[model samples]
Target: MAKDNSFDIVSKVDLQEVVNAVNQAVREIETRFDFKDSKSKISFDGKSEITLVSDDDFKLRNVVDILESKLVKRGVNLKALRYGKIEPAAGNTVRQNVTLVQGIEQDIAKKIVKAVKDSKIKVQATIQGDQIRVSGKNRDDLQNVIKLIKEMDLNIPVEFVNFRTF
Candidate 1:
């Protein structure tokens, strides 16, 4: 009998890179002419949360844009950054929470599951928490699944791990 082949597909963001980007953005806000005097600031709380504060919504948006640019430069996908609703603070200030969403969202995850099923590959796909595991009897079929997935424009980064042949 042929050995079973399998691998796990996961979508995860590196929190350290996000922290570095936030730090760089804060420095830029401090030195930039328009932002320097706006009292806009950014801080990372906990391991994966970023808080942006500004006097006005416009300034807050500017800070977010800068942070997004920094994230892009660091090869971080913008989709991974989930922004909370902006609200007024105690001092009539606006603040927003930028949470790093490392897991695949439900819709995207379902789309991936459907794509894999539609590919006609002889693999069984199961949603394992935030990731997907694919298994098949033939290694060649498993490789084909990987290749096909790569060709699709999922608009998200996918990492293959936990590969094993049973």
Candidate 2:
């Protein structure tokens, strides 16, 4: 049997980077002239969630923008953030929750597999847990699969990992 080349497609976020981004955002808000007297706050909830509170919807949006920019600077994908609706808090403030996505969901994994199958690149893709593994008889075919996947414009961010030729 011919050796197969393979790689795993996974969607993951580094929690430490997220924490750093949140902290940077908080620091900026603290020093920014416009936010001096406002009640804007950003914090991490549990392991993979962020809670943001602000005096109003406008400030909340600004806070989100700051956090997103920081995340981008840290090389974190903005698509990994799943945000909840802005709601009124007890002190007449607005609060929002942003959930960090750490892995690909089953539907997304299936979509990845389907995309690879339809690319006509002579590769077999299978969903393994929260990721998709693509394997082919030629290393070039595997590389083509990666390129094709990048061009598919999927909603989530994907990382190519565990590339093996055997």
Cα RMSDs, all models: 2.4, 1.2
lDDT of 2 by residue, 1-166 (tens): 8988888999999888888888999999999999999999999965888999999999999999999999999999998889999999978999999988877899878777888777788989988888888889999899888888888877788899999988
Candidate 1: residue 45 Cα off by (Å)? 2.1
Question: How would you encode candidate 1's per-residue C-alpha lDDT over 45-111 as one tens digit per residue?
Answer: 7477889999899888888899999999988888677789999986778999988777766787788
Give the C-alpha lDDT of model 1: 0.86
Cα deviation in Å at residue 148, candidate 1?
A: 4.2
Report, for every candidate in turn, its global Cα lDDT versus the true structure: 0.86, 0.89
Which portions of model 2 miss their true places by more than 4 Å?
none
TM of each candidate vs. truth: 0.83, 0.95
**Number of clashing pairs per prediction, in order:** 0, 0
